[model samples]
Target: MKKQKIEISLEVFETISELPKDIQELMNKAQQARENAYAPYSRFRVGTALQLASGEIVLGSNQENAAYPSGLCAERVAVFSAGANFPNQTITSLAITVRSENHEISEAIAPCGACRQSLAEYEQKQKSPIAIYFMGETGEIIKVASVMDLLPLGFDAKYL
Candidate 1:
């Protein structure tokens, strides 16, 4: 077997103010969405905001169900909403943030594996990169040019 390595470039910002004005606002919206998440079961709320080329911003917050498996993630909710509402628009960027009721989260929180796969599909369908910004309640923010960075070997329609 041959050895292989996969690496992705990332941008780290010391604070929200360090990001572009638009991105700063996006993060702020994500924070507000997070506050609205229905995550009583986990006490962990997640929010995601998507910026479309049509100059519209879509927001989604995690919705938890007692069945657990029936719930949806913030990333999927936002992406689905964008697709349903603005099918012709291209998603330019996304911002994600998480807050834990049990503790103060200072480290960045990347999307879960399932969320990555969902995002990868949207990116593939759009035929364009969707910038992804992620962070926790505070501290540094990380930016990736595309969801593929998080799901380097993502499965897509090409495999089907």
Candidate 2:
């Protein structure tokens, strides 16, 4: 058997101001959404913002449920909403931010495996790379060129 290595590329910015103006604005929106997250169980609030090709921005916050599996992540929520509302528009970029107990965590939080897969689906549908940006509670912002970077060899409708 042969073992293979995969490398992911990303950029770290010391501050949100260092990002492009549109990306900076999306990050700000994500931070605001984090404050409104309903996560009494995890107390880990997450917010996601999606920028559409039309320049429209959509925001989503983690919604927790006592049933656990029934609740959805901020990333999926934003993407699904975008799909439902703007089926023809492509998602240009996505920015995610997180906080816990009213304080931003100082480490970048990547999307969970399931969320990554879900994002990969949209990326495939759009036929365009979706820039992804995240931040730790503190420190610099992290930028990934596309969702495929997070979910390499991702499964999608193409296989079926």
Candidate 3:
């Protein structure tokens, strides 16, 4: 067997002001959504916003349940809503933001594994890469070119 390594590249922004105007707007929306997250248990509120091909922006906030597994991440909630509401439209970009109970975190937050898988499915369906912008509670931003970069060897429809 041969050893192999994979590396992912992302643009790091010390502040949201460095992002494009439109992307900055989306990030702002994500920040606003975070305030409404129903995260009583964990107190880790998260928000996500998606920009669709139709120029529509969709937003989602984390919703927690007593049963942990039943809850969904903000990223998945936003992506799934886009898939259901705009079946024909492709997702162009997504912005995610997070907040914690103790204090705002400065480091960027990446999507969870399940959220990456869902994003990968949509990326495959559209046959186009989806840009991901993530920001921490304290407002540092990081941009990734594609969902596949987050989930290498991700399971998709092709494998079924």
Look at candidate 3 and tell me the lDDT of residue 112: 89
TM-score versus the correct structure, for each prediction: 0.98, 0.96, 0.97
lDDT of 3 by residue, 1-160 (tens): 9999999998999888889999999999999988889999999999999999888999999999999999989988898899899999999999999999978688899998989988998999999999999978975788999999889878987778
lDDT of 2 at 49: 93
By lDDT, who's the top model here?
A: 1
What RMSD does each model have against the real structure? 0.6, 1.2, 0.9
The ten-residue window of minimal lDDT in model 3 covers 151-160
lDDT of 1: 0.95
Report the C-alpha lDDT of model 2 over 15-128, residue by residue, as the tens digit. 998999999999999999887888999999999999999999999999999999999999999999999999999999999998888665888899999999989889998899
- Model 3: how far is 102 from its true place, Å? 1.8
Which structure is stronger by lDDT: 1 or 3? 1
The candidate scoring highest on TM-score is: 1
Clashing pairs in 3: none
- The Cα RMSD in angstroms, rounded to one decimal, for candidate 1 relative to the true structure is 0.6
In candidate 2, residue 138 scores what lDDT?
A: 68
Clashes of each: 0, 7, 0
